[model samples]
Target chain A: MAGYQDLVLRVNLTTGKVATESLNKEWARDFLGGKGLGIKYLYEEVGPGVEALSPENKLIFMTGPFTGTIVPCSGKLGIITKSPLNGYILDCSIGGSAAVEIKRAGYDAVIVEGKSDYPVYLLIEDGQVELKEAGDYWGLCCHDTEEKLKKVYGDDYSVLSIGPAGENLVAYACITSDLYRQAGRGGVGAVMGSKMLKAVVVKGTGAVRAADAKKLMDVTYNAYKNDLLTDTNLWAYTDGTPMIVELSQTTGILPTRNFQQGTFDQFANIKSEAVAAAREAKKGCVSCGLGCGNFTRVGEAVVEGPEYETLSIAGSNCGINDLGAIVKFNANCDAFGLDTISAGGTIAFAMEMTEKGIYDFGIRFGDADKYVELPELIAKREGLGAELALGAKKLAEKYGGIEFAMQVKGLEFPGYDPRGAWGMGLAYATAPRGACHMSAWPVADEAYGEGNPFTIEGKAEMVKDLQHYNAAKFSLILCDFWALSFDIMAEMLSALLGEEVTAQSLEQAGERIFNLARLFNTREGLSAKDDVLPARIHRHPLATGSTEGKTLPEEEFIKMLLEYYSIRGWDNNGVPSGEKLQELGLR
Target chain B: MIIIELRGPLARYGCEHGEKGRIEAKADNGVTVRQILNQVPIPLQHVGLIVVNGKKGSLQTMLSEGDSVVIFPVVAGG
Candidate 1:
């Protein structure tokens, strides 16, 4: 309550009108903030059967308590809406200045409803908000759009814009920001485009004061300044996340060639060193001294990425080891405003389909030369890319190869191959936002030997705990990488809120958020059967490495899920029980 | 004897490149992977992915003759 501005601007684009509303203090107390708050809003507004891409679907961009604070890695902004990709409650958070800028703009969140008569962009400067005509910016790619907006609004305004992909309503289109980071899951961008909205530009110079600012600042500064000494943060700052390339591949969980294999033969080419060598310099999110975003020098121009997901999907999964080609493809996706992981996964699925002779789509793994132009084609809805833009599961279903779609709950898989890590398999299947890794990342437990990746003995408890805590962190809009130690995090939160927020309370908040997401999904018709993994993960054994001859045992997974559900206060069917919901004050 | 090249964080003191190191002593006296690491001046705690002859190998795995090893530090990413 102390850090919050206690106000939100609701814009009804159809009527070109804007109205301000007082913050629901009770809801804030119940849901906390960020993804949790956004879901609460969606649950109240959207009904069970509303079409995701329809104008009826409301898009909420919400941040949290620590967003504008001096917390480390607090640049995440959550995009909450009914996803066209999966028809589920989508809470995709991206790292950028948008969350910070919006929070600083004297508001806790921005909720846009109804359809605009024409393409438009929202400009929020402090308390003043304007809906600007985006007729000229409609057809522009994300990079150009951001450049134009920045030029117009100077360097101060943080822009979250969609490109040709979103404009065309590509199912996996991304909402790009800072020309790099994106809310890149589900079809949130498609929902944005469907409403005839293009971008949200914000520039706020206002300051946020926490309940105990001095204590908060002191605690945060000590941790932030000492974060380099920590294992995860230090490693992250040194090599960026792409350094996991060798580790994952060596661990045999790299999700190679549409996840047919765990390890890649050409792993060296997609290594962090290669990515670093290809880059101009490190880049990342707002207020982040550690710039993890890569600016790869591919021939004539320096472009972004071959980040971990992009590297796995575009490189090993696609069979393309050429870092330059991967960089170019990643940059191409960025410009076109498409999710690179989905694009890469979709293309990889297509290539696999092509290999099976199911369709002569002319796709193949490692065919970097051919796929460099695929992003533009997908954004423009051209060629086979039209189908590719529909995302992996749909493309696979259309091509009659749903078995190897490499998707979970209609969302394409991230980088980790489940065979190599069983915990990741559970995480993928049980994630609230489809196949997202962030929902409950068991990477350390699964891939790295941090807490034992292979042991399913106590993994259910770990996953449940992580899911809850992470959900809570998402409400705080903090980076999961920095949530290395929950005890430290609890102390920080307590210091900021001047509340006795123990680890248990944080876990409880996360549980509440998780249940709320489930509640929304349940109301939207997601049943017990929806919680499932692809057949490939169940049937196939890892071809090479430490986990060779290993697969996510179906019975083990079922038992794990049941145990997870039990811990989550859910029924045998994985639905949150009435008692549990009541306990969380959701009922 | 297998030679292990250490890179990234392991090459802390000397250079920015990987250290061209050697593992002269083999498993003649039944030396385990952990013991061989102890023989080396540098510690193995930070090393994450261990590649022995282009395949994934753990610390428990015994060293074989003529094996080419690559030791990487525990870094980030998935």
Candidate 2:
């Protein structure tokens, strides 16, 4: 309780009412904060059959106990809501100073509900909160809106805004903060657009108190020197995510040509070295020592990343090797507030559709010129962009190419090709928020480590454990870049809360949180039937590179899924059992 | 001579021997990957994946002269 502000801010745009309430201490104790806490709020406030874009769907912004503290890599803000794209429980963590600002504003969470008659932006300055008219800022891009808001509110405020993509209700529209960082999946921004809330700006000067400040500082400083700034975690600063491009290529998991192949011939042109060569500076989130962001400029394009996901899905998956073009595409997505992974996956699917004469959008693999122009069109919902805005699953549904949509549960696949790392297939399918890589990343152990990439022997346990680990970690709002173990997290939590916290307790909390999310999804009618990979993953084999002739056999995938459910104490239908629910106190 | 490539922070190991990221090491035919790694300053835990001739290689993987070995750090997240 010492690490918490113990306050919640609720704003109803339709009624023009803003009120503050005490934090749900029982829920906070059980779910902690960030993803877990945010999802718990959504499950309680929003009903099972709520439409994601309707006013009934609430948008919750949450911060964790570690936020605004000296805990390194704890600056990520969690946004939770029903996904407009997939109609599932969606939670996304974005890096920036927003979490710190929100916490300093003396609140653990901010809940925005209902729709405004006109465009408005919520401004919270210390204890003062008001809904201001955003008519002048409504049509601008994410960057311009942030810049204009900063001009009026001064630079000390943290701003989160949407762009044309969100305004047009693009299915994969994302929310942008700090100019570049985004809650970049599952149409959270579309939900914001639906409420006609263009931005949320916060300026807080309060401090987050710790229970044992001396012990917390000692742990923080020790971890900062011994655990955080070490060889195990320095890769974030040294090469960042671009290093994974080569690793994925070498291990035969790099998605290429819409996943028809596992390797790209032009991978060298877009690897970490290429990013470093174009790097102008390094950036990081608040309270971060290992700045993973590489600010790169190529010709007229300037952006923070074109990270591994963008580099793979937009670069090789599209058969376009031009790094400059990929950078331009990345800048376009940031400007338009579109999720790059979904945008790129949809385009690649379209390219294959065009090549196969299914439905030609006049775009093909390696068409860099046409590829760079699609994001804006999609954001504006004009011309071919209108069709592309539907995303891969919806496009495939409207059209006739469902098998190769490269999506699971309506969300597009990330960079790693699942055929090469079989556990990834399970992770993607079983992810609560559609096909999200952050839910669990077993490829790091299988394709990137000493584990066998082609086996399902320990994959079920591995995926389940990793999923629980990630769920708990994200709930604490820690940055994924830190590879600290559960013990470190428990130690920090114990110090901050003035209580005994153990790794075992944290792991149990993780299980409880994961089960609660499953309950949310199942309540909305998602079940084992929805936990499925694209047909191409089961049917198509890669034709080149180290993973040549490899496919995740359908039988092996099913065995893994069933085994995963068994290990998770779930029934054959992937529902948590009564005994398991009772054990987690969810009964 | 076997050409060894080190990536990310693991490049420090290669720098200890020959170049910054690349090292030309003398190894006999049929030498194991563990043996080659022992000759370097890198801790085995620091090595995430070992690749030999574009394929995944284990610690016991046999190494021959003129082979190419790439060592990566145990860093994963994006």
Candidate 3:
């Protein structure tokens, strides 16, 4: 407990009461922190088959030992909850100053349970907590809500709030934090909306201490000085993720026109140089040496990045590549508290659906002007937005075009086209929360000519390894861009916890965490059958591009699955085996 | 002449481009990406993605007549 506060705060909206509980030391040791600890508590508390957006389900916001510490890029909090969109366990880690604020608030995790009779917001400062009436703020957009809250509670306070999208229960509604950052994907915001919770405003003046402060400082500053400011990482440091616009474009994996194409012709207009032209300033999270977040101005409105995902989903995926307009779309999604990935994906699906006569509307693939109305409508669940609120999976099921739905396990795909990049295909099909790139972005080795993306030779094993690595990283609550090796993480953990830990031990815990997640999902009625790619991925061969005529053959998928299962010690159907459970100490 | 384009940071190594990422080089039949890159001033390690005629090609892949090549820096993501 040297590095940890060893405390978890629980708020019950039903009774309007608050309580603090001691952390389970053994479980904390085994699971590490952040998502691992959060899910462990979630599994024990929630029922075997509880409704995702019900009073019985709990929403957890957790931080790792490394969080709020001197470690570079350590400012991340893992949000874990039952997903209303996918009907599965969902974990989305939001980065920025908010996470470090949570850690400094002196709680390892915050759990919200039960439903309030009226709309409410939770305020936590130092060790004090309260539930306040949110009557006046219920209907405002995220931008307005943040502005209002910051004005009321000094500018020093960090706020995480949901907008109209969450208020109306848009399935993929996101929680906006640090103004522009989000705990997006799999409807984390909708679950909050279901509980009648509007926001969590936090401020902490307390300090986060490490066990060996001197050693930690030496290691931390060394990493900050040397590793972060490299020529290799210069692109990310300068242009942020939109730097990948050209990577996805030239590599022929940009998800364009609803994944009907892998390359966008107007890619240059949306790439980094174009985005940098509009960037007025840059910002970083607490303790971050390298800033990947840019404060970009698109005409009259100044907002944070419409990152690669936003650019692709709203711009190229819709067959519109106007950078300024994409930035506007990003700001709109942020204000409405919508997941740009799912929102843009859903919009594209609608566009394609309309093209196929499923519904007659002005929503077209290449029309950026008309799509402006869609985000507001979707947030309010009005007219065509009601059906679109079901996300691509359920919408495709109800209308038609199940084949073209850009979703897996009810969650929409990110910006990568599985048709062009096959590693992403396996990663998408098997991702715990559905098709998320953050699960394992092997594009470094897969699509960008570092390895054979077209082959299944060792992809299953590669994915298995990367998944375990990311699982551990998520548990540690580190940013994906931290790019720290396991050895450094082990050292950091060992120093913080005042214990001896090896890189191998951390990796083993990662494997254990993933298996437990599988066990949770299995009990939640998920199985290997649910781990599937949309038919469009298997049926529609790309007519042009680097991945021309490439489709994942059923046999290849089965073969890869079998190998993946073998590596994870799972059965033929992707269930973790008894021996595997025992080996990971989960039995 | 062989058509080659250097994008973003890689364009500094390229000379005389009317476009943002365009570069032109003397033609050689069945030239590989490595051969064309050897002639460019940028270090081979600094170069990451190499695309030939809209298709991803490696250092060993041979380029034919009328093929357009695009060279990019070592950045991969999203």
TM-score of each: 0.94, 0.98, 0.94
Worst 10 contiguous positions by lDDT, candidate 1 chain A: A228-237
Residue B22, model 3, lDDT: 66
Rank all candidate structures by their DockQ, best first, as comma-separated numbers.
2, 3, 1
In terms of TM-score, the best-performing candidate is 2
Segments of candidate 1 deviating more than 4 angstroms: A450-455, B1-78
- Best prediction by lDDT: 2
* Candidate ordering by lDDT (highest first): 2, 3, 1
Residue-level lDDT for A206 in candidate 1: 89
lDDT tens digits by residue: candidate 1, A1-587: 67688988899998888989988988887677899999999989988889998878899999888888888788889889998987789988888799999989888889999999799999999989999999999999998999999999998789999999999999999898888888888878899999989999999888877888888888888887765355445555556678778878878888788888888988888887787676677776886655666667888545656678888877898998888788788888888888988888889999998988998778787787899989999999988777788887887777688888888888999998877777787888888778988887777655666556665778888778778878888887777556445666777787877787777777788889988888888777777688888888888887887678888878888888888888878888778999998998878
Candidate 2 positional error at B23, Å: 1.9
lDDT score of model 3?
A: 0.83
Query: For residues A329-366, what per-residue lDDT tens digits would candidate 3 score against the true structure?
Result: 78888888899899899889889988989776458887
- lDDT (C-alpha) at residue A14 in model 2: 94
Chain A of model 1 scored by TM-score: 0.97
DockQ of candidate 1 (2 decimals): 0.31
